[model samples]
Target: MKRSTPQEAPEVQVETSGQLPPHAAGYARDKVRAVLGQAPEPVLFARVRLARTANPAVERPVTAQANVDVNGRPARAHVAGHTATEAVDLLQDRLTEQLARLAQHWEARRGRMPVPGSHEWRHGSEPTHRPDYYSRPVEERQIVRHKSFSLVRESPDEAVFELESMDYAFHLFTDADSGEDSVLYRSGPTGYRLAQVHSRPHPAGNVAVPLTVSELPAPRMTVAEAQQRLEATGFPFVFFADAGTGRGNVLYHRYDGHYGLITPAE
Candidate 1:
């Protein structure tokens, strides 16, 4: 079936955490996390600034950004609010609905289940209409966004140290020698790298789902090496014939009832 454009899909942005004041910064920060975290864990970005809106002399508003990873392709959800209550709203309806719909696409492709929007509601299923509901488009979409992050510059040792210390799965950095953008991080059993080429433009509006991506082992990559390394892994994935105006991505997973092994790629 046809799916709505990414613009139609709620833009999923990782929470960008902003800066806070000394006396109330930590406390407010904790409160913000507690409130926003009420929803299931998903990659989010929160940009915070601790500054006086009225005073031009304030310290640059103390602007900073904090981001969490999504299940698939590390999509981000923005969580920002004047108070904690507003932050919580982003998690459930907007974030949850988008992820669920994306997952449904993958499950349908796998022939494991019906499209998420379809069900016999007339029978007995309660109105589970979630908040931040997204309308489905009317078109056939079989494939979604599938991308890999390759690494550059830092050696494997530096990459491992930074990722481990920060407790992050992947790091997007520019290569010193090749001067190209690359990703270094872990996924699955070993570390993996993707040579991000200017060729593969960022998909504009596809929703990203939370998938189980671990830091895989890797020797890091130069731009040239990463492209050659493509298709080396046996991870089975289907590419969409029509990637759409922007990058279209869906999270496919193995079925175990309602739960499935979610892969970040199409």
Candidate 2:
């Protein structure tokens, strides 16, 4: 008779950029493993990136980002600090919190109460410092990235869960109830707001989370128009219905100071 042991999952893959310390990659891998190892669900894949800025003026020169797939769900976290060690430490904490919130969402779906001592998660006030955008003139910037995909159809609460766990500033999806393309984002420190292609009042009782629907309708504009408006308004992003297709699209500023567009797949 023979006994066999189950193989353990592989260590997290770590990537580095810029002039990082030699031990930076290994340290990040260990830190990421420490966090994902305690995940409530199986971690299918995990990758961490550590980057350093050469500019000394940047307060937080070291940035760390992690993307992980827990079972079938995706979660992500990004953080920055003065040093690689600090950045990795912050990443671990943020990733752990994200996974916990995700696990809570799963528990609720199963009609089970949240674990003991677990409280409702709220948006933190910490600012994530991304790469500084070059001072390129808006007129010179071009639409460098265009992403097209099928939007998920889900409830507001589910969308919120995904948005926070994935560390997205805004999430574009199809509203399950209204069947309209919608964007969900943080309204304030503790609340969320929803914007729909056809603006209409949403019944508060239908949504379980703290949410408010936008009263103004999404503007219909072409990509070029949206880009001009974004430049004029200095808004982080613009959500609008495409003038040509009548589908929702998002025009936003990338970290590189270029325009990026997101549209639903045809």
Candidate 3:
């Protein structure tokens, strides 16, 4: 059994879009220190974010988020409470559990599965459900976030690794061998899928294209991989080069939520 020897606690940086109360600030620092104290390796850095939320729960009107980087791996947790102090306590508990799981996951991969019945408390101890964003009204469904990154050419396996490492639900990359645009995403805890796009752009409506088009480099990949990318992104369609024939193709989502592939006939 490996134990973490405590040294100096890493600095905790707190950022707030709105003002945070002084007591809340102090509580956040203390809770973060408590969580990091249990980490297998000293946390490289820790961050706390405080924000007001629209939640109607009287006991959880504020949201707290903790992000910690440990030995190049990152773990994060979010909690809400009526008071900043309550939120800080919850966040501390969550971050501690997450860090423990991270360490255990690495260890389990090295042929050490925890004795199942011996640790019944650890089994399913964490909440597995996620809030359903679609439950919100359509009028409130506008995009609230945007992220941009360069497309790296990678295989399905490589894309899977990247997705997990970044803690993202999906990943986009060009296929190194097929020269097609592809995406990788988790279908379940134990499974992953891929999608790819067509090589050429489809006919568009009578609307002007974006004034700025990013001339991105494309990589060759399998059609199956391209299809997965198309599905994961929830895009209306995707355009990419055909890995098989090096021709342009289009993968589109149908009204029935199924996928359709359009390729120029040779």
Candidate 4:
């Protein structure tokens, strides 16, 4: 008997968080669908969200967000522009780059093509999706909240799973491969990225070995489940993946104790 290949399922979904023109919504949905059609593997689903920024005069008032689910893996990207159509076009390009990389990684592993033998492949290029604010000179920013937490040991994929399943802007963990302190953070609209913490710079000008942070285990859960956990623990915030989009999100307790949401934007 011969084994049958699993069927592919690549569906595109588009919805607006705020009031949006029907043409804009349709354009976004169509763009994502056309891009995913080129994916080497079956994209489980792709979701696009469009919204207008509060600042009317902003150069990029129209924000577009796209989330792609490949197999059980999730990837997200976003872009902004003056119009929904322009934003969606850029969003498609970003999504194409992401899916291309995923395809490269998987294909290389399967020996389908010569392992990516480029300089960027050997030495990872600086991520282009990071926000512009990060490049600006550091201002008088102070650590408003400093709490020590144990560093969990996990792979990059597992780290993302943990980060999404808990209420934290970032997660510091020991890389299972390198055994070094690593930070997983959501840098702007590029989704999640990992940084290796070499050494801590002391405020007083002396280097430190860093506090022996304790590891906080995170369990994968849906957004609704995360909200329930947040309410049960009386915690200020809860982080988890949106079941519908497979994207990370934060549900926080507002001043009035009502729920507030924070999600990646372009």
Leading candidate by TM-score: 2
| After superposition, candidate 3 runs with Cα above 4 Å error | 1-4, 17-21, 54-59, 105-137, 150-266
| lDDT of each residue in 1-266, candidate 2, tens digit only | 22222224447998899999899999999888888866767789999989997777677888899999887888999888889999999899889889888677666556676432312647766355334554567667998999999999988887888888898878999988788999988887678899999976764345666788998889999888998899989988999999999999999887666888999999
Each prediction's total of clashing residue pairs, residues at least 3 apart in sequence or on different chains, is: 47, 0, 28, 4
- Residue pair clashes in candidate 2: none
In model 1, which runs have C-alpha deviations exceeding 4 angstroms?
1-72, 88-93, 114-266
Using lDDT, rank the candidates from best to worst: 2, 3, 4, 1
Q: Positional deviation of 131 in candidate 2, in angstroms?
A: 5.7
Higher TM-score: candidate 2 or 3?
Answer: 2
Tens-place lDDT per residue, model 4, 118-157, is: 2222112223322122111224322233233455667655
lDDT of 4 at 214: 23
* Candidate 1 residue-wise lDDT, 1-266, digit = tens: 45322321222233323343344445435543543343223434432222223233332222222333433323222333343334344333333333443344455666777533213111111112111111223132222333443324653333433443233334455434434344444443333333332322232232121112223322333322332232243222211112221221112211111111111222
User: Candidate 4: where is the Cα deviation over 4 Å?
Assistant: 1-9, 114-118, 121-173, 184-266
Worst 10 residues of 1 by lDDT: 253-262
Give lDDT: candidate 4, residue 103. Answer: 69
Residue 162 C-alpha lDDT in model 4: 45
lDDT of 2 at 133: 50
lDDT of 3 by residue, 52-131 (tens): 54445333456777888877777777666666777777787767667766665455555566522213212232323111
